[model samples]
Target: MTVSRFYSPQSIAEATAILRQQSGCQVLAGGTDLLVQMRNGVKQPEYIVDIKEIPGIRDVTLTNQGLTLGAAAPAQSVTERPDIAAAYPGLVEAIDMIGSTQIQGRCSVGGNLCNASPAADTVPALIAVGAVCHVVGGEGVRQVRVEDFNTGPGENCLKRDELLISLFIPRPGVGSADAYLRFTPRTEMDIAVVGAGVSLSLDPMGTVSAARVAIGAAAPTALLVEEAAAAIIGTTLEESALAALAAAAGAAASPISDKRGSAGYRTKVVGVMARRAAQIACDRAQQRQRRAH
Candidate 1:
């Protein structure tokens, strides 16, 4: 029997060294996913490196670049920032929907992301807002786009000795807004069967100038559907445009059958969620425009 080694590294350098030197070391951010995996025999790390005490990783900072969410910060803390909630309501909605209130207290967005569940709520929202992740390791720092971060379910792009330090999401500009929606078996405390996130920028004339559409629980990984965005751009998202958007989004999904939902059901629901989420985003964008005036 191997005894699990626990480590509470107070700095990135210390954590990186341990990860590089140890044969099996896993990061312990919120331990939301780590503990579950350990119990299920999915992961058996010899070393558990607690990084919550790492100076910069637990602090959320707003900047000209946008809102920087420290990887170690709790999901609940993200909603407490009024400025961030106002700027990126869709992200806040997604972050807030992660598990229940108690789970939110301990789960970090970074953990949800790195856990790489196809049903993770935040992935689509992050992709819709063009979020970027800052990763640190023995080789130093690098950035990865949120859309490109996860390779598949229970898998991520993180290499050995590497961990996400922070996530950066752009601040919504004037006439810009976003929204997220998910279909679940239950009203609350349920995994998303089909999730959609939409972000858009509208011109003064009410036509979309820029747009992003992303879907989760509909593929091996959450995906940014550029064609769906193209379907609604340059229009007020009329029925014709929305129909196209739905069709394109539906076409992008390649889900597998599961107890939560079947592949066909997930595909159809993604189209409906995509259209609804886009409409909500469009409405929010118009509201932002009015607020700006």
Candidate 2:
């Protein structure tokens, strides 16, 4: 058995320094994914840098401008904040599905995103809401859109010396809302066969003024489906628009055949999931509009 050295860093600079010095060091936020991979020999790291000890890494802040979610914040912590839940219900729903109750206590959204799994439920939702990743490194801090963060399966844009700090999301408009839905073989603890997330803003006349559509488990990385969003942008989410959105979603997906489902099946099902999620988002947008008045 290979014994790895563990270091708990209390500051971002300290953590980044450790990451820069170590060649094969793994950052541990929640350890839900890392520990499992370590045990299975999927990842063999010589050093483990625990960033959970960093100040404010687990804090959740919400303001009028939007939200600043700590990268290491646990799923349970995010779900417990009523302000966060109300402001981004679709994101909350995705976080809630991270794992079971026990796992939720330790699973962090940052870890989920860093894991870079194509089926990560939160990635699609994050992309739909236009979330941006806050990263720090030797060169200083920089921001990357959630949709552009992940490069491929189990890979991301972060450099060896970089660390993700938090995520920022702009405040939704009065008539804006979002929704997320995923298909899995089991009800819980199973990878998504397909995941769809949609966010839309409605005008006073109920026309969709803006929209974003994203999907997971259909490619090497979670995808932002601009064509799907374009399909519903000028309409009131009517059946004709939904049908077009679905078709666009199906067209954008490039899944592969596997045990859980086949490529053709995933392609077709992603359309259904995207359509349903859009309907849910539209309904939520209407509700937001009613409440704002």
Candidate 3:
């Protein structure tokens, strides 16, 4: 057995320097995914750069701007924050549903994002809320929208030398809320066949003023369904509006059939999930409206 060399860096610069010198070095935020891949022979890394000890990567901070979620921040850490839970419940739901109860404490959003799995629950949710990824490297820091972060399954826009620092989500406006839902073969420990997330802002007149709809596991990457979002933007999510949203969602998905579900089935089911998620978001938006008055 070849022993994998491990380095735990306290600073971002130090970490990047190590990565710059090494080839095929794996960044360990939460080892939940990395360890599994390694054991399964899917990944072979000579060096492991552990960033959980880094100052900014493990913290969950709530500010007036929004949540500054460290890339290494555990799902449990994010879920435990009452402010984050209250602010982005849809994100909280996605983060919390990563794995089993015990695994959540060790699963980081960064790991989930970096894994770039098509079925990742958090990707669609992140897109729905317009989160940005802050990545750092020897070259410098750069920001990317979460929606554009993933290029394909098991691939992302990150260069080998770069590391994600944190995720930033702007504070939702008043009368705004979000929701996430996914269909899986099993309730727990099963990958999603399809996932849908919706975030919407309601005007005082109960019309959807702003909205975002994202679908996951139905394409090469998590897809931002602009047409689906447009369907409900100027109207309440009535059945007619929802029907249009579902139609758009179905048209946008390009899934491949597998043991979990057929391509056609996934396409149809994702539309349903999108409509359900939209309804949940709209309901929550109304609740937010009530709370503000």
TM-scores of all candidate predictions against the true structure: 0.97, 0.98, 0.98
* Tens digits of lDDT, candidate 1, 1-293: 24378899888888888888887788889988888888888888888889999998878888766899899899988888888888899999999998889988889999899999999999999999999999998888999999999999989999898989999988888999999999987989889999999999999999999999999999999999999999999999999999999999999999999878789999999999999999999999999899889
Among all windows of 10 consecutive residues in model 2, the one with the lowest summed lDDT is: 1-10
Deviation (Å) of 55 in candidate 2: 0.7
lDDT, candidate 2, 53-162, per-residue tens:
99999998889999888999998998988988898999999989998999999999999999999999999999999999999999999999999999999999999999
Q: Which stretches of candidate 3 lie over 4 Å from their true place?
A: none
- lDDT value, candidate 2, whole model: 0.94
Q: Which candidate number has the best lDDT?
A: 2
lDDT tens digits by residue: candidate 3, 90-187: 99989988998899899999889989999999999999999999999888999999999999999999887889999999999889999999998788
Among all windows of 10 consecutive residues in model 3, the one with the lowest summed lDDT is 1-10
lDDT of each: 0.92, 0.94, 0.92
* Superposition error at 53 for model 2 (Å): 0.8
lDDT of 1 at 69: 89
Candidates 2 and 3, the one with greater TM-score? 2
**Each prediction's RMSD to truth:** 1.3, 0.8, 1.0
Regions of candidate 1 where Cα sits further than 4 Å from its true position: 1-3
